[model samples]
Target: MNDIGTILGNEQFARKQASFGPGGNVVPIPRAKKNRQPPHSDTDRANVLPLPSTNIPHRTQSGLIPAHVRVLLIQKNTEDRHACRNALQQTSDFNVELVEAGNGGEGLHLACQDAFDCILLDCSLPDMDCLEFLGRLTELTSGLQLPLLKLVPPHKPELAIEAVRRGIHEFLIKDEDGHYLKLLPVLIQRMLDNRRLAHEKQQIETLYRTLIEHIPAITYIASLQISHQWLYVSPQIESMGYDRETWLSNPDLRFQCILEQDRTMVERAFAKSCETGELFHCEYRALGRHGKLHWFVDEARIIRNHSGQAMFFQGVIRDITDLKSMRDELETHRYFLDQHVQSRTEQLEKRIVILESCNTELCNQLEREYLVCNELRKANNLQATMLQAIGAAGVTVEESFIHPET
Candidate 1:
């Protein structure tokens, strides 16, 4: 099959009718200069129309050329329908099976009978206003996404403009030689590619929303201003006894919910983060339904614009009431245990002082007893020495007492 450059060249050379301006007047075609770029190769033609740049998932089933496409061709004239069919057959990149309809009623009927990958609409269908037909078609297939490409006559650029205003996906001008028909395959491919991109984006958004809504924490986006106006809050906010709508609607409700004692701490942290463009983190207590106080760990960061100016805040709030209670309980236990240990240590210190005093008194008594023992030994030795002297002197007191003792 011929590529896009060959097709464009064929269309240009085959043109027989003069172009028309917005006033419906003839515009003379300029003759091509001899200085022209050489014909583009297949690779160059491929480069002329590349896929849009995006991070969406790869299109395995739908790419530059879909595998099989069912197109609804709505043109009243049989000759024009046949020409469109012939043009669609010129390409080898993909296969298109046409379902032809003579008028808008027949086209809508055929659309209801089955599904179509795209719709080829001619702006000049008989028996119906084109806009009315479009409105009816939209109503009938409200759930179905039908991408329509309108074919407008060269003299009726107003019709093309009006069709665009009415949300026509794409349009082409008709000509005498019907060379404009050759663009059908390329246009259809581009329209489908765009549709696929839109579908991928929507799917990604839905997946992310599901994940955020079901998680155990509440996610939020808010303004960085002191008022802290809420931009978005996840459905999980309901777990904290506040509805999502209420949290979003009331700008001051978030601050009001915070415990009075912790409001300053939260505000200070938020201010510091906004000034420095740093992470805002703080633990605070908030009043829930029925005046119940819950502890929360709020973590947020300043979202900045390209120039590094703070734009807004994105954050997550986790209910840490259970964790906070456990920590407080542990602290209380530690405090009491410390007091008990301190009391026991003081008692032990007093006992040690008393025992030291008793030990000193016992040591002094032992020294005095040692001195008395030394004196007693000296006295006994002296007495023994005197008795020895008395025996040597032959003592007369005992002999004088023994005369009357018989």
Candidate 2:
């Protein structure tokens, strides 16, 4: 037996017996303290054996095992195995199952067979070195698990460093003293917490990547330094006629693609926006990969600190060449239509003036004919009066009447 077992035996700390009733089994009571008399006061008795309360942080029974948190513990030492088991027993909140393996080969076998939340590996296993085992672990759990922690001896710090380079999560050293056993609980808790955090971080990153990918427009982030580095380019870079890595490496090339006429305007707007920490929007022409000129609309805003200083700019660029072309065509058609309508209106006005002059001439001719007719009627009346007077003076009446009739 180990030194821990020997000490427990000497202290007469018996494994308390428990009874299994219909409801379930009750927790075994710890051995009574020697030289301690029973308490007389109610408060003292309550303190001696505290009843389990609903307010306790941990449950009496372990919770259901989560699909993501199946732990595999691969330790060759029997003492380490027992320490881990005891630590898990203390943790009643989380359900963690252990898979023991004596060597790296057996560990790899188990890892391949099932998914795991975290892998606890010893650096000095019998079958293989830690580095080789880690390489194999990486291959086996590629796109499967998060990461694995390396178990090392207290004396070998170099082994921990090498294991970390091989993509281990963290290194744990075995302590010779009994204090190591006490620390096992805290270590296990930290490991579980780190695993959960890593999984959450990965999920958030994936969601962000998906969101950026589905956006219809091109999106990117650029630094505001004099050189203007491309901090992040969206996955749409390929459709932009440039690969992501090529654009990231070459800032001068990107600048060269900007139209010479609008480059100054772009720079001025960017500088003002950055200084004032305001949104900047501009339209400019860009040269595509095939040397074809395209109109591009860029909209960006300054990302600022609490003190209101610009840190960087994130923006999107859209190819507006087709839109601009359509707008120009519409404007041209509108101008031609306006000119045609004005010409037709002027011609109609001239024709109306000529028709009005013709109507005035016809009215003048009709007025002259009416005056002549009136004059003739007046002359005939005067002549008739003269003839009637002559007839009354006894002149030849028949000749005068015939002359009047002629």
Candidate with the greatest TM-score versus the true structure:
2
Which lDDT values do the candidates have, in the order given?
0.74, 0.65
lDDT of 2 by residue, 1-406 (tens): 0010111101111223332223221122122335443424665333332111222222222322232245567777767766766655554345455666667777777676655556778767877887888888779766344456666767787888887776676566655543444334345555555555555666666677678767866777788998778788786766658888888888786668888998889889888887777788989988878877788888998777899777778888887889999999999999999999999999989988988888898889889999998999999999999989987776666668768864
Clashing pairs in 2: none
In terms of lDDT, model 2 sits at 0.65
lDDT of 1 by residue, 1-406 (tens): 1111111100001212332222221111222345643654676444332212223333234345456677778888988887887777765556677778788788777666566678899989986977777888878866355678888887878888888877777887776656566567767877777776666666666677788778889888888777888888888778768887777888988889998999999989988988888899999999986688789999999887899777779899999988888999999999999999999999999999999999999999999999999999999999999999999667666676776565
TM-score each candidate.
0.69, 0.73
Identify the candidate with maximal lDDT.
1
**Which segments of candidate 2 are over 4 A away from where they belong?**
1-68, 143-145, 182-189, 305-309, 373-406
